[model samples]
Target: MVSTAAFLRRAFACAAFALVSAAHADLKVGIDLSSTGPAAVIGITSKNAIQMWPATIAGQKAQYIVLDDGTDPGKAVANIRKLIDEDHVDVIVGPNITPAALAALDPVAASQTPMITLIGSASVVEPQEGKRVWAFKMAQTDGAMADVMTRYMANHGVKTVAFIGFADSYGDSWLNEFKRFAELRHIRLVATERFNRNDASVTGQVLKLIAAKPDAVLVAGAGTPAALPQRTLVERGFKGPIYQTHGIATPEFIRLGGKEVEGTLFPTQPVVVARTLPADHPAKKAALAFVTAYEDKYGPGSVTQFAGDAAGVYPRLEDAVARALKKAQPGTVQFRVALREELEHAHELVVPNGVVNTSAKDHVGLDQRASVMGAIRGGKFVFISE
Candidate 1:
């Protein structure tokens, strides 16, 4: 019943440990995030980040077993099965995206595998609290994002929200939660529109919504892929405020839309420049260290601090994986399930950004309890956790 990924991982780790027993301990990690089709960048970042962990840990490298889920849940299941049954992975970190995350969640959960995911879907973990017991999120949820944006807007006395989301689950999920959160806060619900993830422009939608005069537009699109709306806002000359969900690419938005993308903002992991950042910063010097380390490992121009987190989260997950490995008793499975109790609602350790206080009762690592807010200033992220 062990996952092929887990199986492969064990074999690889054992062989690696045997080969390098003196100065380093061996670990086998399975990456099923992206190895397949177009999502290669995500997979590459994920794998590279995970690989960098052991590189940074003790100059010891873990053997990695990688597979791409191909954006198909079925393919995802098959790939996970291969990793579980074939690779014998000790624990699994990701399949990325909602569908793949969901596809592998149950199967891996049943196998008592520990899965650290960044997927924001609340349902993936069920019960929202202690559902799978083996699952954890390094990524914040849509509701967490909604709460941040809505509360900020409410505090600022802004109302009338028009949703400019993609026609997909990720977007739709945010749209639903945003509306729900907005309603709870007495914010007016205006209109909603969709855009293509491929090439269709959101300029028309921005104009249409601008004509409606919503106080602010809420956007939901893929990382860097959702730069369309900001571009739209500029081309059409809408002066209203813009709010973004977590996924949009800040650098791409800025690069593509220039001044229009300047003020656009969303929730993201904290990034600070040590020298320039305030000493009171919660993310502090370590956050800046992550950026420097990431650049050193990946080479310059690999990813902006915006999506740098899109990739930076991997090391955080690696810490969770290593932590799981330690607790994996001699007889215990040491799979995702065991790690779930330790990771999901059990611990609060600093990853790249801030401390992730997750537990069995709280699945999202941000603690469903606190929200971290940041604004892009002069091209850098400034924490406003107030």
Candidate 2:
């Protein structure tokens, strides 16, 4: 039989171990994406990247709970609620569609959870006031991409351009940003039109655009749906240069557009053309690492800009979690707040797509270094210029 003093010492040691274990509880990440609807191409690639993340982050085991939003805002909101209310996730990631990401804002903000979005639109995190303070974005903003695209057009003598985009928030953001940048570059906007993502024909829009006889045409849509307008333009015999936004950086866009998209140019993250990025480019090594790893698993030329954005989330979390662990244990309100604060303080943190330097004011922190002009050539995305 043990003496009373020895028994007391054993009990104290067990209690100490229990306390330590509680402090290092598993970190939970909830992911919601449009994995089965219109944005499936984008969401699938993002999911692929998320799959490659290690089982642990910053010395704590991580549990990832993924949900499909079906590219619907209602579904996204539902999924976010489930993640927050039921799962009690520490952080939320995704909802790659613009509207979906916007819809998720309330749930995350209400729960004081940090969200790292993979969507291209900046509106989700911009004006960093109100509920947006808890949100961050991994993709480069349309404004930044527009700046590069318009500059390229100016250099190439694209004096006048026609705009055809989605009939949704995604298109609205692109049109606003592109218009602002184009005007600054003296590129006249001759015509503007919009079409639904699921629409089978953009012939009417294409006819209006062709009638304008602009020097070039810019299609501001995402995923495979973006191909409809470009294909219609080519079919209708509008031969001037055609431009697309970074939203079309997936291989599905090229596959769907076929030869019609062969000469299409756009501004995209470095990872879309990782192998072709200049040796000294800041994101080249990181981009290549992602490309190699992703292609190794999913097959060559399978990676997309969405995948690159998702892959970057790991490094951001790793950086933030390391700091947050000191403040509070995972699975608690304090830990989520600490994670959000640390994420805001990111400085020169390099990810697969670009160098991030987020602040309280600017949540989507990317510069010219994050974008490169790319053209579809011989069925592949090739770097045109920085």
Candidate 3:
């Protein structure tokens, strides 16, 4: 995780440049999010999420370049460099995947370009002890998500738990985390299963886990494919409580699994469930309003709230870039430096998530409340503290 303090310190170490003359001034921003191919399903949602927010909110013209990452890290790094060195973009909005986000971390921070991304790995923030200020997640982390799950499990008397993971970067990361936290929290991890992302049948694994009879099963893959076992259990009439990471708990699973996913409980940010937050809570309100607008723009009946994670991060990415631009003195170096500096805001402000107290000391621009327990109710996500 990027420690806020160390990142801020390094951000200051990367000095700013003198600005170019005021003539051809246009705030050109570059976006390297997944916009096409398999990732587009998420990229388009995030793209709209970024655009829906008022651009000038952070003080910058919304001139942008959205690139298709093709879900490749090397390509993401190359594109990000081009945007900074060749395109001379004032800031950046993305490269959503954590591995892809990892590829660009050193490049953007070393180049001193302030950028935000939809990453879930803590390595991006800490990046080997020193802080990489320019990198951050528009979404929450898997470890933190694990923390919530463990706490919930402990609270609910769920002692023996099973984990079904995709064997991908996200799944592996969290599976390891869940084991570690399980030990710490005294929760016995009864069984574990892994499946390929392309596997259409997880019946064998589901049967294996069913035999284990875990108090609860946690699914950690990315899409409907990961929800296979969760769905199959229902087919076999095995209906113990089911838990999952935010990724697989989409409406697509509901449409794909039909009744199987109906009662599956998943951990997700509460922002999707509320139409507006309580008047006293701005973040809650922001999440509700954002979800409402998103549903209005693209009918919710057919969409999954988890997809919104992609959409929701872009604007946050843009805002950081905009701030960096306004404070950047001149030239690529200075602007990049400013981008790095302005992006560190846990001390002064809180964005959509709550208590985001990141700084040079903390690189994880997140807090505990960024995650909440959610369930699919009547075919839609319903957030409940329980």
Using TM-score as the measure, the top candidate is 2
The numbered model that scores best in lDDT is 2
| Candidate 3 residue-wise lDDT, 1-386, digit = tens | 21223222222232332222133445666788766544455565566555444333245434556677876778888999998888787666677666777778777766666666765556566542443666655567778888887888888888898888876666778798889888888989888889876677888888888899888888877656656777777776676888877665445667776777887777776455554234554356445545555566667653344345544444344445656656654345776676566556534233444435556656556666577777777877776665
Q: Write the per-residue lDDT of candidate 2 for residues 1-386, one digit (tens) a residue.
A: 11112211221122111111232349988899889989999999998877777666777877878899999999999999999998899999988999988988899999999999999999998889999999999999999999999999999989999999999999999999999999999999999999998998889889999999999999999999999999999999999999999999998898888999999999999899999889998878778777877787789899999999998888788878999999999889999999999998878877778888889998887888898999999999999873
List the candidate 3 regions with Cα displacement exceeding 4 Å: 1-25, 55-57, 127-131, 276-282, 301-327, 348-350, 353-355
Q: Which residue pairs collide, candidate 2? A: none
Q: For residues 74-107, write the lDDT of model 1, one tens digit per residue.
A: 8888877776776666556677666677777776
TM-score of each: 0.78, 0.93, 0.82
Task: Identify the runs in model 1 with alpha carbons over 4 angstroms from their true place.
Answer: 1-26, 35-43, 55-61, 70-74, 128-131, 272-278, 299-337, 344-346, 368-370, 376-386
**Candidate 2 lDDT:** 0.88
TM-score of 1: 0.78
The model with the greater TM-score, 1 or 2, is 2
Q: lDDT of candidate 3?
A: 0.64
Minimal lDDT window, size 10, model 2: 11-20
